[model samples]
Target chain A: MSGLSKKQESLIKSLYTRHGRKKHNLCICEGLRCCYEVLNLNPQLVEIAVCSEDFDLSTLPAVASEINFIRVPQEKMKSFSSTVASQGVLVVAAKPEFSKSDDAPADPYIFVLDRVMDPGNFGTILRTAKSVGLTELWFTAGSVDAFNDKVIRSAMGAQFGMTLREFSDLDVLAEELRRFGYNRIFRTTPHEGESCFTAPDLFEKTAIIIGNEANGAAELDGSLSLTIPMPGNYESINAAQAATVILFEYVRRSEGGA
Target chain B: MSGLSKKQESLIKSLYTRHGRKKHNLCICEGLRCCYEVLNLNPQLVEIAVCSEDFDLSTLPAVASEINFIRVPQEKMKSFSSTVASQGVLVVAAKPEFSKSDDAPADPYIFVLDRVMDPGNFGTILRTAKSVGLTELWFTAGSVDAFNDKVIRSAMGAQFGMTLREFSDLDVLAEELRRFGYNRIFRTTPHEGESCFTAPDLFEKTAIIIGNEANGAAELDGSLSLTIPMPGNYESINAAQAATVILFEYVRRSEGGA
Candidate 1:
């Protein structure tokens, strides 16, 4: 109670909300593993909050000593944590800034996430896309905030490394990316699309659109679509699972010498 | 207050635990959607529990009328539910019986889940396995129970349609499957394994082993391992996401005709 003041506590709590995160320009990373990743990446890290009695800062990486941090009681960490489970370590960092890069490839393969509401699904998609070597990620306005704590936990630090772009209108963003030489913007659909296994010319510059959890993607005029051929009668797979299949298919087609 | 007897409430809650489910030889299906799936699948559906006031029995399929059911007040339903967000509908069904048919084909591609713990990840693997035309699913001991409420929700009803077998010891299970004519047992690993993209003879009677969340699969002597080539520096992808990529790759290789 004496270590973290009421003002600091309120500030930490505010970061859980989109409005507060935007106003303060901060992102909160919880759990020891994720905090370790943030410290290792060393990307605009502000401070780390830890349980005063139980947590030993020396156990963390050497870079952790270079950053500003605070120690609070275990109960305080629990009270401020947005997740159901807290790992007693929370890192406050300035959100990685988003901007168009000059060195970005002319015909890059980007991922356009459309209104993916679930934080876990959004985070998994980020991790999967990054694993497949996707350098750039874009999202529509309605999707979950990329910096949300749950998303950061699920993403496992890909959010820190990838170049991210947020757009208010997808129609405008599609046109801009197409002009920048992103040739294909394929909206993933559960049906009425070409099978990814047999689709031709998959090596071209592409932007695969991953949709919302329940509603799927918004209709984008003139855009192509792709489907993972499902042999069973199950209604649908999870959004993250679907995105993983599509992203890997892109990689397979591009690199398999097909 | 008298709508749902105390006996019924306790009975429903008991199914939440693995011991209770095993003793009763039943599984609990939570949420309206999952309950509907259980009714439609008609896989030994025992009974359905509904909120007394708001639930309309007629909205369910005609086959629902053929099953035993009970109606309880909304609060009673809440008390019996295991999930944080209960949908006020629960169904009790017999545990799906597992057996290898005598007429089974010589070469069958199976998914051997070795100690996958996360319910959400386990469920996603089930749905993906089913989507890719895999009918036989085997789980080694120490994995999360397949009928768990979280697994049931994430699986989106795949559990109702698949043939699931739980084995106490994986070594024994592997030997049995081998004797049953499963020629290849490929354990999925993160490194130093055959690349799925260029791997030959993928269509053979194969069983892909997906490992645990934290630790990879237990090393099985003489089992082949397959790796998904990752171009990034990230540690690894989610267990279910990795499994999905691998499952779809098998589909692509065997059927794509590339």
Candidate 2:
């Protein structure tokens, strides 16, 4: 295996920023689990896989052989890593592209995020969205970058399995949703809305909007508001946790359970 | 308003570690939200409140006048903060203490955590637990320190409002649960066991076990296993997300909806 060249090193460092990732059309997936995930599930998008000298090659999947592998010293790998403890492996892959024209036939549910700035919350929401069988995610303009390394790590590689779409304006997103036959648009509020458990038609032609961590969703014209009843009367739960509860309620309802 | 003393500065820095927190019987709450939380909700616990010179005093709760408030330079405040962007306010409070004798009468629900190592997950779980009206939490020995700054930030100061109990062994925890009349002990699993929605008696005299993020719960003898049905058939949702779904299901059932 060859060592990473100076050009490659600079590129890997640049992957940490949104402008750089956009400029190169590439994102970095660090740690052994993410690297393995990209290799196993989306190998075609991977351009290079870098491993520290001590990293075991046998543990890699068969698809690793088809990709360009670079061996670097442990110290060098640490420098390129975003995590406190580097797992000795990293992968640079093309950002999966999804356009407005790529909608699946009769897709009933979509999770729309508006200005969700926290990386951990954004990533956790992605992981939950994927768990609930969502094939695509929509984000408003002010949301954190989907390809951020912290988001990637928190998501545990869910980005590999889902399509992400960004909309510059909420009005435009609402228009597109209506055009796609999503008749029910729901926004979560801390209080004073339909109880999520009893909210009808959550799994049918629905788009649930999870708002920003602090400010919450921008008012969507004609959108129904839903609230998860907090008997404890606490102000709110974590944004990601709230999204998970609502999404899984969709799962619970779809499974024909109460 | 006086600047922090050298000894006080050293103590605040040490509060970042479990050892130091234990030694001082104190924990640090950084950022304006958390500091305000401790000040407003648990005022007696606040030992010292520190803020950058430019921090607005009018925004603080009325109780701020009862505590020692220190004014420091913005740069100095940053030096003592654990977050990327300090909110210009930090509070050092005595860690809330709870013991075996403090169990609430007829308390039917308890969330037990087994070796949950991720600070973000632990904190998110704490936030969800509080939202579900849970007043106490139990943790296995290997779990992350509940007072760690990252945990505090993710929990959004939920720690100030709940009681925490840590056990040296799962057996001891189970025994404690039984003594408290918690007959139904449920451990979450990625697969198998009863579906959370259909699980009988989840809200009646129940204790739910959330496992470690990676390896999951260590086998608890006689514990019933429960699973969140994933329609997407993804490997699993995030641990915090899973806990949220299950906890809110408790809310749903109690509300007589599901």
Candidate 3:
């Protein structure tokens, strides 16, 4: 019986590395649910691999018909997994490319991440950004690879719903955001700054930078440094939690007439 | 080369189980940062376990002087650990006990977790609740053990800063909150009811219920079920993310002059 080709397996595994993903122009989306989700939303998927034991051909989404569907032994499928709990389905999809010239949507909000190391946090930020209708997200060089298996899983397939770009440097990213007509760059911090609750407006063309888990976006020289105004003295919030607070604040201001 | 006794090791490991934690009235705080933090905040810690290889006695927190500090072999320490990446220090501390009659602080806000299964999410919620100045968190029986090693590590020592109560049942928990004078129970849901941005007075004497990762707070009979109001077609925010958004919104309303 024909098995998953060596080239295909290598491509899926290569998504674990930035170099591999960039070279192949492909990233792996794993878990049966995420595969179906990404495939449904973005039919740009090249192929999907499923364990024969868990394969239910009848439940495969319509988009799966448009892409190569390969079956592998249940035991063999584990080797290709990036997660501890593999759902036995993996999708190989083309990386959605975004550049400086990509047109911004009406009232665009961009999320910039600087050296966020935790794959779970990175993915949750991506999912939260997508939930708030953020069309674009940029990460500086030191940030974790967004296409890493853990991140892809944590993102819950939000990667397929938005534009993701990794810049080599913050200065380069700042220039790119400026080119894209972002008028404000708000760097999220836990320290002294304008309270996010009282910030003038987040509805305009803006880029929000959320920093690393330990040391925040100290490197980013954004136009405004926004703080969440934590009165509790219980230490600062986590990166992803802070990001969601700000993301939904944008949603609140835009929709609730704050 | 005598190290942690069998009793001490057993106590630390017991925190991984709800029954064990409750029986001993103790919980484990793992990792270098959280161990030091919990020790400094609670000072009720009974002991500290450090791997001899990673031990820097000079860097130990001032509170360590009041407790037993044992040095174990690195390999032995791993056996006692619940985390994949233990930082070689774990604090055995008394759990902060709360009951129905525990006095609420002025304008007290309580966080209720119905059946949050994910330890990481539960821990993040605890950290967020602490960060927002919520001194009390109530968890019904089915939620993940708050003192589980993963929750303790994920909480980053915030567990020591707040009062944690695991109620045997939601009805009992609800009755207890009412006795504590919480006028409203705001259940967090991803679906529609009331926009949190437009909801009336989340900063008052309130208890916010964050539910399981999948089913949400369907069990809570809150005065109002609050939604984040996602303008995008994205499915829903993660449990912890939704809780943080609501928690900070309460902060914003209270501190930012709503």
Candidate 4:
């Protein structure tokens, strides 16, 4: 019952060879949750691809009619799957603009990563940031490709309305965020003078910069906390975990009306 | 200069398989930092392999003399390497006895993962736990093999002198730790009850059970916490990150003298 067109197959295959994400500002979203999320949000989804014959259309909202589901072979699905598991569903969605909107809080808090190498870490951070109402995130050189298939799967569908921009020269992003008045930036560190719990809360105009896996941020110098861990055997936690602990604390403080 | 004996080649290649890690109880440590870290502790090294003739060994500690040096074909070294970039160094070192040595804290705190999947996350968390002196880490059935190359690399040579046990059934572990009087076994969750810091500070025979990537540990209904963020954008950090945050907090309370 699959009705995949050769033309569509060629299109996505062409996408694999090119930096379609960097060039076109889009990435592929796979599986049930991500598709459902984008469907619920009614965003600009380029197309939906399905390999199963019994693909359900009823669970989706009426706007789902607008979603294009081209059929493809399961083999092709395996080849295209970013996740180790193929959930038999896929969509190509426009990368959301992290740029703040009027309905979004007037003072937007942002998260930025510099060359975080793991896709799972990247996705988990995105999922948490979205839950906490982060409006935008910018990636600097050395970060993983956000649209990477592994990232799509690991994000657990948080990419639906997320906005992201990758800058080849990350050092320049500080000036750019400043243009948007996101000048109060905080960097997350396991080593820091202040505990993550009591660090200054995220103001409306804040940008949180996370660092590389091994090295701290290449450009980060004067972060609020330089050493957070106790003198102990464990030198540092995973970078993504460090970011999550600090991010959640920021959100907690924000929620408490800090 | 290529003097890799057939026996040496087989031994190193055996490490590529799981049987190798189990049979020899040794893992391959590659790159300059790991090689030196192994040397610093003066581990029972199997041998040292170098791909380049120009690699300077003058500054390495005198303990390195006991290490057998085998120069392999450069192309093969590149093939076996976990990292693409190379300083032309690799060593196979015995997995130090992870049992609670006198070095182990008397309180005997442990960290647990239900089903952590990523090698990097597992490695990073293992490193964090090791840093915090939580050397007694036992893995549930579905967790990744602790001795995998990526995990070894990510642990940053911290795997030394650590105990990791894989139980065929978590029931045995749950029963065992329970018998051991870990009355305060807890799990970390953003959705649940107590904050980690506020949750009765734990010491002496404690276990922190972290869950899988998609599902945090199963709701054993007894030990859970209010999930929190990293004070960054992520609503959740990757499993590695989550484990790091939780494990280090345990470290801080136990070792931080806070």
Instruction: Sort candidate 3 into its docking category.
Output: medium
Residue-level lDDT tens digits of model 3 in B119-212 = 8899898888888777777888889877776888788877777777778877788888788788688777677677888777666778878887
TM-score of each: 0.91, 0.97, 0.90, 0.81
RMSD of 4: 4.4
TM-score of chain B of 2: 0.96
lDDT of 4 by residue, B136-249 (tens): 677887787777777877777766656676666556666666766665677766566666554555555667777787778766645645454434343355576556556655
Interface RMSD of each: 1.8, 1.1, 1.6, 5.4
| Better structure of 1 and 3 per DockQ | 3
Q: How far off is residue A232 in model 1, in Å?
A: 1.8
A5-41: candidate 1 lDDT, tens digit per residue:
7777788889999999999988888887778777766
- Which residue pairs does candidate 1 place in steric collision? none
List all candidate RMSDs to the true structure: 2.8, 1.4, 2.9, 4.4
lDDT of 4 by residue, A2-81 (tens): 46667656555545433766676656777877666667664565564454444676655566666567656667787776
Chain A of candidate 4 scores what in TM-score? Answer: 0.81
Better of 1 and 4 by DockQ: 1
lDDT string, candidate 3, A106-179, tens digits: 44667889889999999999988988887778888888888776788889888887777888877788888888
Q: How accurate is candidate 1 locally (lDDT)?
A: 0.77
Candidate 2 TM-score, C-alpha based: 0.97
Candidate 2 chain A least-lDDT 10 residues: A98-107
Identify the runs in model 1 with alpha carbons over 4 angstroms from their true place: A56-60, A82-85, A100-107, B1-3, B56-60, B65-75, B82-84, B100-107
Fnat per candidate: 0.70, 0.96, 0.82, 0.39
Question: Candidate 2 — which residues are off by over 4 angstroms?
Answer: A99-106, B99-106
Docking class of 2: high
